[model samples]
Target chain A: MIKKVVASVQEAVQDIFDGSTIMVGGFGGSGLPEALICALRDHGARNLTIVANNVGGVQYGVGILIANRQVRKVICSFPIGRRQAKLQDTFWEQYRAGALEVELVPQGTLAERIRAGGAGIAAFYTPTGAGTGAAQAREVRSFGGRECLLELALKADFALVKAHKADRMGNLVYRKAMRNFNIMMATAANVTIAEVYEVVEAGTLGAELITTPGIYVDRVVEVKVERRWQG
Target chain B: MQATESVADSRLTERQIAWKVARVLEEGWYVNLGIGIPLHIVNYIPDDREVILHSENGILGMGTRPPVGEEDPDLVNAGKEPVTLRPGGCFFSQADSFAMVRGGHIDVAVMGALQVSERGDLANWMIPGHELGNIGGAMDLAAGARQVWVAMEHCTKDGKPKILKHCTYPLTAPDCVKMIFTDIAVIQITDAAPLLLETAPGWNPQDVQKLTEPKLLFTKPVKVMDLTGAPANK
Candidate 1:
């Protein structure tokens, strides 16, 4: 069986280059791979293409990455901030200055492209952006006798994910809904890094309980408790 | 009735009302339970049923509230409260979840209301004083669900009527509600209009009328019904 080598979070993310496309798994503040994020922040990578469910809270998760000025483009469904007013101000500032390249995808379409990338499919058709602003970069097609928007798969150079548990062989288990973006992202990256809370023995995790198997994972890091923070 | 008198009403206590609402859910029902008082419904779902709970941020197959110690930073409902996932539950794009909602796949949507008009119009996502009142998926859920139900108090905190002749706030759904269950009575909306199906025990139709601002169209005389076992008044 293939095994995942355990290393420190910094070492795991040390190879990431500036202007790389990276997929970070988490929804809002939940299940975000904080260890890898902090490592990237410390690594001082800039002009990054980041994909996530939402920008993490102002001082946590993706927000930290944003604050560090590491992100060049963001593909997401919602804007970031504690309140709508704050979110609006931040968005307006970024947009007016042309500093942020924001691609606003319907929450479902964004998820599907990530899933399709993981599934090894190049592209899929959807009705989600048929007539919306999201149609700008995509090709249109007709499927099943209806007009559908064709979106390309979104794979990245690096994917950082967090899971509740994992074995040396890399089979991962996520707790509850925290599993959101981690499983799909594992297959969608050239180099997938997982920061797991617990690294158990291989085969220790029951077959039914395994969420993302080791075949998709390339690196493993045992996250230190000191870096994890609650929102 | 004396204005100062506290009357024994027949509506289920909040806990009982939540339980009663949960009991009616069937397997595979795509549900959107509104925030506030309606959030309590999640606790009452039977373990055997395969109901898939949906939040606007795009999670499905959501489980009951997690134990206190196990709160994960990542798992949250549309209200931004941490939540648990049932067995076999998987996470997908929130956009896809809304697609399921907008595509008319959801079976039922239960929501809470500040006020509901006699015409079955719903006004729940906002109140005038609130600075931020984003409707989120409420509009889509109301329009897409085959059935829509509103659960709320019969009267406002200051004894003002919530069931109105017309809503004062912006509308969330246009004539979409099927039933309105309050602490005082259960009213059903039909072709003829808002029909008074049942009255709270000890309160007469006249009493309910005085509190309701809308001119109720009651085709038949209202009868009192047993309150579903909600948590007993604390």
Candidate 2:
């Protein structure tokens, strides 16, 4: 009957292996697949390469992964957060100890690269970091008198994303600004696992409202998490 | 005007400088406010004008902070601080949100700068020797927005000029800034040079010039900043 639902978070992340490139979706604390991340943490896949907006605050999503020493490298816009520095966060400590590798891209370029990866395009030129340090050691081209930097597409072994709702066939819908990187990451991964608030019948989700079509998603798991910000 | 007594004394408070920048925003404009001083600009936007706020994470028409306990972790601004959405607000994916920026749909991008060049260069995201700092959306906003306005203190806390002949820090974007609002003066970057547009009360062109590294140009007479507690439209 085209059921993609997984029984447990552990089962959803069981296939992940060491040295996998994982895209963990969230901007700040929003849209984080917390239970899935915790499951991955317990599953203990080592030397992971993570791509996301931030490393997450010290005790939060990606931070826990980094704290557990599961991540070897990160490609993100903001790896070292200002507030996290005050508390001597996990990323800062590992980064200072030269244990972690970072590839920082401009935020827009990061988003576009993931988008390109999903669409099967090789690479694109963007003016986001054209004349700055980000453009250093990269090819630059001019179009209509504006210089642009060439940014390559990024694909991951798996994408862990959070969504508001999902169907048995794995069609996904996101809520608010929480939609951030989840939509793009879902498309750019070899296997996309979505942790959603609810999983409904295949015909229940409106066709027009589906942000990620069932074709891209491989598994769906319902995970109800207490909102972390309220405390 | 003495150096020690005058420059520090005449400098506007951070809130006052934000109010001055907020007063200048046009109606029906889409503005992106960077973290720190630029975030304060929202509190002082004129009541008569309806300026749409853009948060880079994935929201347009960003509104004020939600009251305690009503906060939604799902909704946040570029700074990762929880925020509420305005009536006409909408959300999109990260790619679509940045498209609004890089597509030139954003009108003004207000940012805080560590250093600025007379030719409208900006350097804010990273330090010279530091291996990593948060780039975030600063570069895209600087290059993509129609106008880039910088809000910052005129000098460093140690009494060094931030407006420089050449920026020592790494450039965020070249030739992007259009105007600068500082504690002591409002400098407008023109095709020719940076011009002295306005100064704080009790300060003059010469006094402001002393603290600034680059030579100030006088294309026209400078006026005292209006800070009578009335909104700009009124």
Candidate 3:
């Protein structure tokens, strides 16, 4: 059995290299792996491709990386700031200058693509982008008399996630609707790192309550109080 | 406008009610049709009118349903069911899609209804016994739309009345429904009360009252129209 628990998020993501693709799990403001992200910023890794639901809110969460210019490209479903007009100007300026590479994915397809990556599927066809700009560069196949666009699988070099609780062996429990993308992306990366609010002894977490099993997790970090952005 | 006559007009069948409701749709309206019974509205949209459909999953300018054997697994609506897009359609992130909804870009939102109260309060997302999934973007759509409409059967499958004095299920939007299109009648919900506008063919206002749990307010006499030959189901 692999030992997964660590003392801090900094230790969990210690080996991530520059230019690596990383998956950060969260939905809107909930269930974000903040400790791991803060550690990534502290490491100052650059030219990274990030896959996430949102780029976090302004002044906190994923915005920290954006503020530091550590992220080169972002693949996300939404990019909203907590305070409107705060980051819009900066984002627009960077986007217009082509300084930042951004690719927006449909929420459902994004979730499925990550899930497919974990499941070892190369690509899947769907009708979501049959006649839109989103279908550019993708192969279109007609299935069952309907046109479907092919979407490739998305995998990351590292996966960072936040869970409500976990055992020393890394079995995770998510709080309510916060489970979102963490469960699927946990298995879609080469190194899966998890930050938990509470860590218990191995076998303490019931099998039925574990949303993500220990088999997929490589490192576990325990975090104290979660910091919030006042803005 | 008498109570007895008004109640008589409110008890039509689902198909019959859908056809009558279709006439109110204007051309070139940006509309978001919710899952379930509201989806049936697509079958009744007028061919002459260009209705741009927006899905919360990030597709705008959607077309009629695709043909069999051509279903695309990736091409789905907000409900995660397969869908087809119209010419000149665009796809974006769920964030942008919601920006369209929350920014007041959508003109109308037609949703399925489990319970509609006399006060026009709507409770459609969850019931007491069902397991609730993500609210997705329904709450935002319902709260942000310029107008909210509901389409549902007159009564539940178990013969329980859905039109109530007040909704008991978890609410998707509070007092957001402007008009309710039911198998029995088309009731326009105003700030004051729900007024009976039209009734199903053959069903009297009395028949409607018997099936409805709430006391419906009638402002004027209602007429029943032929709702057959609405748009073909896609």
Best by lDDT: 2
For candidate 2, what is the lDDT? 0.88
Choose the strongest candidate by DockQ. Answer: 2
Query: On a 0 to 1 DockQ scale, where is model 1?
Result: 0.17
Candidate ordering by lDDT (highest first) = 2, 1, 3
The predicted structure with the larger DockQ, 1 or 3, is 1
Q: Pick the candidate with the highest TM-score.
A: 2
Best-to-worst DockQ order: 2, 1, 3
**The TM-score obtained for chain B of candidate 1 when compared with the true chain B:** 0.85
Could you tell me which 10 consecutive residues in candidate 2 chain B have the lowest summed lDDT?
B1-10
lDDT of 2 by residue, A86-133 (tens): 335566678888788898888988999999999999999888877887
lDDT of 3 at A189: 96
The Cα local distance difference test for each model comes to 0.73, 0.88, 0.72
The CAPRI category of model 3 is: incorrect
Q: Fnat of each prediction?
A: 0.21, 0.87, 0.00
Off by over 4 Å in 1: A1-3, A81-96, A127-152, A201-209, A224-231, B1-38, B44-76, B84-106, B109-234
Ranking by TM-score: 2, 1, 3
Task: Summarize candidate 1's per-residue lDDT along A1-231 as a digit string, tens digits.
Answer: 566866788889988998999999877666778878988999999999999867755455677777666788887655453443434555456656777776655555677789889888998876644433335577877767655677788999999998888888888887655666777788899999999888888878998988788888988898756432253
Model 3 Cα lDDT, one tens digit per residue, A1-231: 566788777777788999999999865545678778888999989888899877754455676777677778888755543353566666656666776687766555677688889889998875544443445678988978756678889999999988878887889987533466787789899999988888988877888878788888888888976433222
Q: lDDT of model 3 at residue A116?
A: 83
Clashes of 1: 10
Q: What is the lDDT of residue B231 in candidate 3?
A: 38
